[model samples]
Target: MKASDEFQAPGLDLFSFPPLWPGAPYWLTKPTLMAVVGAVLICVLMWAAFAKPKLVPRGLQNIAELGYVFIREHAARPFLGKDADSWMGLLLSIFFLTWIWNLMGVLPFVQLPVSSFLAFPAVIAFSVYVIKIYVGVREQGARDYVGNLIPRGLPKVAYVLLVPLELLQNFVTSLFTHMLRLAANMFAGHLILAFFSAVGFWFLFERPTLLGVPVGVLGVVMAIVMTGFEMFIQFLQAYLFVLLTAMFIGASLNPKH
Candidate 1:
């Protein structure tokens, strides 16, 4: 078969999978199932690490302790400062869950990242948003919270433009961007992988010819290299998710007036 005849490029449809439960809605599908699995994995890991604390950490506890230190120093401290320790549990969990959710994109059979679906990342972003609003109102009082959102020393005239922008920034845009950041990265990464994988399969297995053999080899190699790159992006996005959450929480605690 001619290359054009045999090879069909993948598209957004590559992300769609028929539901495991035929009647289930589009939102309840493989990506969601993988998220559920990621949560279970996190629970088991935490249990192994801290089910019974030891004065001298070893094995899973050692790893978990190291993770705690990483989250505290890297994710929490820069934003949270004195509040870091108190927020460790929530930040650590969010970091790990987001990390694993992105990881599923590259794992062998489970090649779908839950965060790519938007709804998966929505949970974490929405949770952080609620915490930010609640903490701001509870700690600063409602009027102060609104005042804090407005920049100090601004001319009275500037308040008209700045207030609506800051209000939208704090309330709507923050959460929307947070969710989009994670989902867009994962979605684009997975789609790239699918494209290269499809190319390799088309040239090598579907309609291989001597002329296309080298092209197939190149396609597979590129896919493998991109997969490794995708793994790094996944971890980075996960860390970023936690970092932004901490930043938002910190702002709410001590708003930038």
Candidate 2:
């Protein structure tokens, strides 16, 4: 058995998709379609879950109520304090939307997390950035907002350098970090899951050999293990994404201590 006979690993090209339609518009790739579909599905779920308030909460209402509590407690209350319930709707939407995007990656037919693509997360992160700034301005007057954002206790000599740096940190750096945190996790998770699935498929069926049997089994095991871990990560990332958003809003609403 020469070294060359061993399987070649998959590369980033695996994440790339050619045109779904050779002659159609270029933007209509699987990831784009999936993202749109996921958004629509979220709208439907929200409507179904809470269109009319129920006295006792059955089925979807029960689920919706639980979600409301979870999002308020975990993503909103700690940051927003007494004003938590006021922002539950937006926080809930962000949490569920991101979760659905990630769940798509693990679903049988749809194997890609739309958020793995940078555009989706960037859009949401930028939206949060815009809202955070807007709320800051509205809550603290333009002058005070700027005054509150930069570090307070620093010496006057440090202000010359720190002001611009802190402003950049508050806006631009937060935007980049918010988007990258979500996208990078989804991208890496999708790649890993795909790698193991590919290994299992290739070795167990496509070109089965005595030497490949153990490798194939290992791949299957790893894929399962990673899938469980990825699910945990998916939930955690969604929480973190919204938690950061709440923090941003909260920070903007009140001066830093």
- Give me the candidate number with maximum lDDT: 1
lDDT of each: 0.90, 0.89
Which lDDT tens digits does candidate 1 get at residues 224-248? 9999999999989998999999999
Worst 10 residues of 1 by lDDT: 1-10
Q: Judge candidate 2 at residue 112 and give its lDDT.
A: 87
Best by TM-score: 1
Off by over 4 Å in 1: 1-4, 23-27
Any idea what lDDT model 1 has? Answer: 0.90
Backbone clashes in model 1, listed as residue pairs: none
Q: How many backbone overlaps does candidate 1 show?
A: 0
